[model samples]
Target chain A: MWYIAAMALSIGFGLSLAALAGAFGQSRAVSSALEGMARQPEAAGQIQTAMIIGLAFIESLVIYVLVIAFLLNGKIPAVDTIAAVMEKAH
Target chain B: MSLELPGWLAVAEEVFIGYFGPSYHESEAVFHAALVIPLLLLFVFLSTRRLEKIPTGLQNFAELLVELLSKFCTSLIGPHGLAFLPLIGALFLYIFTMNMFGLIPGFKSPTSNVNVTCSLALVTFVATHYYGFRYQGMGYLKHFAGEPLWLAPLMFPIHIVGELARPLSLTLRLYGNIMGEDTAIAVFIGMGIGAGYLPFQFPMMALAVFTSFVQAMIFALLSSIYISGATTVHEHHAAHGEEHGHGAHGAAQAPAHA
Candidate 1:
């Protein structure tokens, strides 16, 4: 029964945690890069390139979490069994 | 807004049995591979054939593509990057073509599969480490083990995890994005998820095409970045002062940039 709840919780929380973190990191990165570009427009090209590479790296972390979520789903207990057990408890 | 998704895509593709390594199953990915490889080869052949002094048609388009790719790859990797043109160029074209094919009505994109993406990531993984060892020799292990021998126990695992993460990330990103796009399209066409209009699906399809291009560019760009990171040596760069040609020198010159 707990396994059933754990499956959904992990899938949801795992991905959301990743997504939330990634979004924050990306926002910070883009804002900082933008500020640097604004300060010195001449170096904008370098800033942009580095920003892109850094962004990809940050996104990879979220992607890893996504894969983990999928793996977690693979071990989820049979839904009907869980439903039956839960209903009997109720 | 009724969207029609073909039935075959719902299941695996064809499979043939028992040759050398288990029953060879030709899934949608392998089927796409069968189609894409020959198509890619034909494209290369046609674009590159004929030694005309004045380029026209396919020759012109091919040259422009080569130039653009070379510029991008070299800017990322420096002088020795020219040697990588074949690998990087082929990767870009193959990925780009497969992605474009995905945009077509009835075609399966090879990159939509994790297996296909993993294979490509494996190639990049091999190339990165091979070049690292070749360029840095015994010292390449220093990269994996990190600095300070005492930290070996800690850093080694960290580096190992980091290295392994790279290919896994590449595999997942490509597979997830493309596959997600495919699924979204299918969902949209079948029931019109949000907009609930047939014409709304067109915009989604357009978005898929745009995403295909962006993902292809990101894949190529990230591969280049990884290769450059693997190949760069602080000692060699400082000693030789062989700055990358074109516009990258500006980045190298700016000490405070990064």
Candidate 2:
């Protein structure tokens, strides 16, 4: 029980760090895009599109970490069903 | 913390029968590593066999490849980077080949494995600090200690944790992407065959190819960026000196502000 709680807390902490990093990354990317647009006004459309795509890629890493955290926390329904059955039999 | 699931959800299955050491595991990443080792070795042997002042055919192509890689590294690490060209080139080629291996039949991409991705990330982690130390000597250790005595408490943990996170994030990102794509393709293939929907494989195949290439590019680009960051010294004062000119006023005032 304590072990599981600790594991969950760590996962939650890791996820928050990832989220914070991602937020910082996205803001920096947007600011860079805005700066580029200011430098070359005509290329704003292209710059914005590229920035959005890049932001998606960067954010996807955080999403991947979140999925892993969920997986690690043993939250999958199929696996939980099997484990429940095994525990009942035991 | 391990899941035991049945049918296609079970990630491992024998892909092929072989007369060699063991039965070739279909989804096992070690099989991919075994294939990559020899392919990379052969490439290295052939490319390094002969020296040519004026090159032609395969040698010309190989030299051109090295030249381009050299230019990329040099631009990232400055002119002195040519010394590390062989290491970076091998890393890029090995990673690129390992990544492309997923497109081959009956072979999983070794890089698609978290263990393999972590190994690669660890290599990069070591290489970054190794080069940093090589260039800057023992003072490279000071990077962790913070610039001044006052901020060490705050900066120390942040710097250390951030450094540790690099490999974890790098490995997890690459592994998650490649493995997820591989799983999706497998699921698609299984479902398509079951439903007699063969056309579904085409789009999945196209997606797999695109994902493999993009993952390889991202891995290489991130590794290069990390190497550049680790090696290049941040010259905050130099920039200030340039702005205010290199006279006595600039140098004395900057120290006063500090």
All DockQ scores:
0.30, 0.16
Error of 1 at B68 (Å): 0.7
lDDT per residue for candidate 1 within A1-90, as digits (tens), equals: 566687789889889988999999999999999999999999887888778767876877787776666667667766787788789999
Fnat per candidate, as a fraction, reads 0.24, 0.12
| Candidate 2 segments whose C-alpha is farther than 4 A from its true place | A1-57, A66-90, B1-27, B46-57, B234-258
Q: How many backbone clashes does candidate 2 have?
A: 0
Taking every candidate in turn, the Cα RMSD to the unseen true structure, in Å, is 5.9, 8.4
Please write out the lDDT profile of model 2 over residues A10-90, one tens digit for every residue.
Answer: 888998998999999999999999999999998775565456446646866786876577576674346577578679989
Show pairs that collide, candidate 1. Answer: B3-B189
Model 2 sits at a Cα RMSD from the real structure of 8.4
Candidate 1, DockQ score (0 to 1):
0.30
